[model samples]
Target: MKQKVIVQLVDTLDLGGTERMSVNLANTFQEQGWESHLVVSRQSGGLQNYLNPEVQVHFLEKKSFKDLKAFWRLSKLTRKIKPDYIHAHSTSIYWAVLLKMLVGSFKLIWHDHFGLSDQLEENKRSEMVILSKWIDRFIVVNHKLLDYWQKLLPYRKNSIVYLSNFPYLKLNESIQKLPQFTFLNLANYRPQKDQLTLIESCKILDNEGFDFRVLLVGQQVDSNWETQIKQKISEYSLQEKVRVNGPSEDVTSLLAEVHVGVLSSESEGLPVSLLEYGLAKLPVICTDVGNCAEVLKSGELGQLVKVKDPKLLAEAMKHSINNYEEEVGKAQQLNQYVLEEYGALKFFESYQKLVGAVK
Candidate 1:
C-alpha cells in the first residue's frame, strides 16, 4: 500500500487560494494511490464543497491560539495519524513544527502562498524567522520568495523549491459563449489586492468612452477594504461600468467569457487567477507584483502596469482591447507555457523531488 500523505491547514472553510490549493494537492495525492487527509483547526468555511470522499478531513476543536490544550490536541492527532508526510500551508507551519517536535516522526514540507505584502509586516516576518529552523523544505511560489526564505533561514541552503499555485481549471462550455468586453478580476477585497486601483483605472477607461464591463469577483475578506472599494466606485459613478460579484467557484467559466483579465494587486505570490486567465486564453493586465510579470513574460503574454497608477493601467487596458486578437493569440501561447510549466504532472514531479530530499 502507498504511504499516506497528510495536508494541514489552519482553517478548512475559507475559499482562499491557499485552502483551495491544499484541497487540489490532496486530491492529486489520492489519484496517485496515496491516502490523503486534511486536518484543520476549524470547520467553518467553504472548503466542504472541495473535499473528496477519498480524503478524510479532521477538524480539531482547539481551545485557542495560545492555549496549551490546543497544542496537546494537535499533537495527539498527529501521533495517531502517523502520516508519511505532513505538508503544512502558511502560519499553520509554526504549529506543525511544534507538533512535529512532539510526535517527531513525519516529514515536514512548508508550502508558501502568501504574497510580498504579507512579508512586510514585522509580526509575520518574526513568525517566519521563528519557524524557519523546524521545516524540511520551503516551497515558494516564485524566485523572490525563495530568495527571501534563503536570507531569513539560511541554514536550509538546498531546501527551497518553486511551486506555482496554478490549478487545473476545467472550463465550462456555457461560460465560453458569453459576450466580449467583459473583464474579470478574481481576488478577495483587500488593500494588497488593490481593487481600488482597478476601479480607478476602469473609471479612466469609462471617461475615454471604452465599451467594456468590469466584473470584480471575490468575497469581502476585510470589511473595510470592501467598503472602501464600493465608496470609490460610487465616487466615480462607475456603477454602470463595473459589477462586483462575490466569490464564485466557477472561475474558469468566468475567465472563458471575459476578453481580458486584470489584477492590480499591490503584492502577490504568482496569483492563480492569472494562471487561470492564461488557461482560458484571456489577455491579462496585471501590476508588476510577485511573479505576475514573469509569468506574463514582461508583456509577451499580457501587459504589466505599475501598481496604483490608474493612468498607466487605463492605457494598458485600452491597448489590450485595441489589440484584442493579437493579445489573445499571445495569451494562448502563454497558456501553453503554463500547461508545460505549472501543470499537475509537473507539480507532482517537483513534489517527488522535495519529498525525496526530505525523506
Candidate 2:
C-alpha cells in the first residue's frame, strides 16, 4: 500500500491559534505515517519552529491578495508534491480552491477557524457559497460553526465535520513553578481578545489587595491595539501586575511559571490555549465565549465568567485563588479529559476517517 500524502495550507505561522493548529495538524499527520508537507502562502512567523522535523515546509512569500506569482508558485509546488489531500486553514482555502481550478483534481478540505461564529458577515457567506462547489470537505472546531455551515450548505452536510481543538504540548513533569499567583492570558493583542477587559479585572483585583501578576503572551499583530493595551496598563498602574510579552517559542516553559490560565476574549473558537492550560494542569478562568463553556464542561472543569465583566472576572480570579486546592483538582480532571478525548491517537483516527471519506 502506498503512503498517503497531505499538504497543510496556511497564510503564515504567526504564533496564533489557527497558525498553531496548522502546524499541529501537519506534525500529527506525519506522526500518523503520512507524507506531510506544510505550505505557507505568505511569510513565516514565530510558530514555524514548532513544525515537526519530518514535515516538509514550503513558503510562497505572497506579497498581497493579488500576488499571482505566489499563486503560480503554489500551483507548481502542488503539482510537484501531488498530495492526496490539501487541507487549507482559514483564509488559505481561497488559495487551495484557486489551485484546484488552475491545476487538476486534488481533494481540498477547508478548516474553518473563524472567531465570529454565527455572526459571520453576509459578504463572507456569499463568498463561501460561491466556493462551496469547489471545496470537497469542511472541518469546524465547534458544533456551533458546524450548525452554521450546515445551514449555509444544506446540500453539502455530508462533507462537514466538527473536531475539537487539542493540546500540542510536550509535557514535562519537572517544571519549576514560579513563586506568585501568576495568571496567563495566551492570546494575540486584538480587539476581540479584549485584553483591556482583563486589565480592568486585574485593576479590580489589585484594589481588593490581591497581589497577582498576568502574563499576556502573543504577537502584537495590531499596533493600535497594542498601544491601547499598553496605555490601559499604564493608566491602571498595572505596570507591575501586567507584562505584555510578544509570542514565545517556549509556551510550555511559560505555562510552568503561571499558576492560573485565563482567556478574557470577547470571542473565540475552541481555543488551543485553553487546551494547553489543561495539558499543563493549570486552573483556568475564561470568559463565556465560543466553545469555551463546552471545553470547560460548563464550569465543572474550570471557571467561566461573562465577557467584558470586570467585576465578575475579578470575583472569579479571587475564587480561584481562595479555592486553590479545589481548582487544582478540577484542573487535573480537565487534563485527563483532554488527554482521553483529544489525544494524538484519537485525533489522527478521526482525521484519517475524514480524509478517507473525502473521495
Candidate 3:
C-alpha cells in the first residue's frame, strides 16, 4: 500500500565500477516502482547520463573529507526523504554512518565494493573498522571480501553477505564483432587495473604482426597512473595500436564494435565490465583475480591469466584471436551465466529481502 524509498549514496558519479553499480541500483529501484534517490557527495560525472530521468539526483559538491557543511546538507536531505535504507557504496559509508549518527533513523547498509581481494589486510583501514559498528548490513561483491570482513568483524559475521554485481545491460542474443578485430578494456585508469600490462601485451601483438586495435576506456582517476600508461604506450611504440579515452555513455555501441573484451586488473570484485562483456557476448581474456574465475567458470567461459604477466596475457590474446570461432562459443555460454546469475531483477529482489532483515 505504501511506496518504499531508498537512497543510494556514492562519493562521486565517476565511471568506475562501484559508481556504475550505484547508478544501476538506483535506476533499478525506480523502475521497480520504488522511490529511488541517488545522492552524490562530491560531484557527478558522465555516469549521470546513464541514470533514468525519473530517479531523483542530489549533489553536495563536498569540498573536503571533513566538510561539515556538506554533511549538514546531506543530513537535511536524508531527513526530508527519510529513506527506508541509505545504501552507501564504497567510501560513502562514512557519509551514511555520519547520517545515522546525526539523525538516528533509516536502515544503514554498506555495500563493500572493494577491488583488492588478494591482499585484504594491506587494504584495511582504521576508519572503516571504527565505523563498522553503525552498519546494519554489509554486502560484498565477492566471497573473498565477505570472508575477510566476516573474520575481522566476527560479531557481525552473520550479517555479511556475498552478492555478485549485476550490470545495467541486458543480454544480446545476436552479437557482432568489428571488422578490424578490436579489443576493449572497460576499466578506469588506476594502478589496480594494470592497463600498462595490457599495453605491453598489445605491443607483443603488434610485434607479431597482429592487425588489431585495443581501446582503453574508462574514467581517468589518477592522472599520474594515466601518465605512466601513456609513457608505457610510447615506450613500446603502440601509438596507433592502442587508443586511450575516458568514460563513454554509449558502451552498448562500443561493445557491439569490439570483438574481444579484456581485463588486466590485478584485483577486482565481480567486475561490472566482465558481466557486461558476457551480456555483449564478447570473448574475454582477463587476469585471474577476485571473482573472475567464478565469472569465467574456471576458464570454461573465457580466458584467464595471472596478474600482471604481460607474456601470458599476450599469449592468451593471440590464442583468442587465432581461435575466434571457439572463443565466441565460450562467450555465448558466459552470457547465459551472467543473465541467470546477475540479472537486475534478481539483484533488486535480493536487496528487498535484505533490507527487511537489517538490524
Candidate 4:
C-alpha cells in the first residue's frame, strides 16, 4: 500500500493563495500514487469542490481560531490516521508539531508562506523563538527569508527549501484583448495588501482625465478598512472608476480581459496573483515589497515602485499604457520565465524530494 500524507490547514475552502496551494499540492500527491487527504479546521470557506474527487477532506469545525479543544481533536485525528507524513501549511505549524509529538509517528514539515519578519506578531516574537526548534523542515517561498533563516537559525540551513507557489491556471492560445477601461488588483482587503495605495493611485488617474476602471478582488478581511476605502472613493467621486468585486474564482478569466494587473502589498511571500497575471499575459505594476521585486526580476518584467507611493504608482500605470509594446515584451518574457520555473511538474518534484528524503 502507498504511504499516506495528511495536509493540514485552518480552512480548506478559503479562496486565498496559500489555501489554494495546499489543495493543489495535496491533489498532486494522489496523482503520484500517495494516499493524500486534507484536514481542515473548518468547512465555511468555498474551496471544498476544488479538491480532487479522490482525496478526502475532514472538517473539525473548530469553535474558534484559538480553540485548544480543536488541537486535542487534531491530535486524536493524527493518531487515528497514522499518516506517514504530516505537511502543515501556514499557521497550522503551531499545532502540527505538538500533535506529532503527541502521536509519535508522523514526520512534521512546515511551509512558511509569509516573510520572516511577518511570521509572528511583534508581542509574540518571544514565543516564536521557542517554537522554531520544533519544525523539522522550513519551506520558504523566497531567498530573503531563506537567507534570514540561514543566518539566525544556522542549524536549519540544510532543511530550508526555496520553492515558490505554482500557477493554478493554464493560458489559452487565442489571446484576447483587455477591455479599454479596466485594471485589476487581486488581493484580500487588509493592511498587508495596501489597498489604500491603489485607491489613491486611481484617484490620481481620475483627476488626470484617465478613463480607466478598477476591479478589487478577494475578501475584505477588515470591514472597517473596506469602509474607509469606499469612503475615500466616494470623496474623490471615483465610484465610476473603482468597484470592489469581493473574492473570485474567475480571476484568471478576468485577468484575460484586464488592461493591467496591480499589486500594492506592503509585503508578500510570493503572490499567486502575479503568476496568474503572467499566465494571462497582462502587464503589471507592483510595490517593491517582500519577494515581489525578486519575482519581477528587480523590475525587469514589470514596473516596481515603493509601497504607499500613490504618485509613483500612477506614473508607472501611465508608463505601462503609453509604452504598450515594451510592456507587452516584458509580459511575454515574464510569462515564459514563470511557466518554466513554477510549472506544476516542478512543484511535484520538489514535494517528491521532500517526502523521499524523510522516507
Best by lDDT: 3
TM-score of model number 2? 0.97
User: What's the lDDT for candidate 4?
Assistant: 0.77
Candidate 4, residues 111-229, lDDT tens digits: the string is 87764334434423345446666666778787766776666677667877888888767445465755665778988877888888888998888888887788898886789888888
Q: List model 2 lDDT by residue over 77-116, tens digit each.
A: 8889898899999988887888888875689899999987
TM-score of each: 0.92, 0.97, 0.96, 0.90
For model 3, name the residue pairs that clash: none
lDDT of 3 by residue, 52-133 (tens): 9999999998999799899888999988898888899988888789889888788899999988888788878657678988
Candidate 3 lDDT score relative to the true structure: 0.89
What overall lDDT goes with each candidate model?
0.79, 0.89, 0.89, 0.77
Over 1-359, each residue of candidate 1 has an lDDT whose tens digit, in order, gives 55756656555556677777887787778777787878877554665566678887877766567768767777877777788788888877878888777787888888887676345544356676667667788888887777777777777768887888767667764655446487888888888899988888898898888888889988678999999888999999999888887877656567777788889999888887788788887788899988887898888778889888989999988988788888888888988988987787788877887798775
Ranking by TM-score: 2, 3, 1, 4
Error of 3 at 232 (Å): 1.6
lDDT accuracy of residue 324 in candidate 1: 85
Evaluated at residue 147, the lDDT of candidate 2 is 86
Local error of candidate 1 at residue 292 (angstroms): 1.2
Residue 81 accuracy (lDDT) in model 4: 74
Cα lDDT for residue 234, model 3? Answer: 88
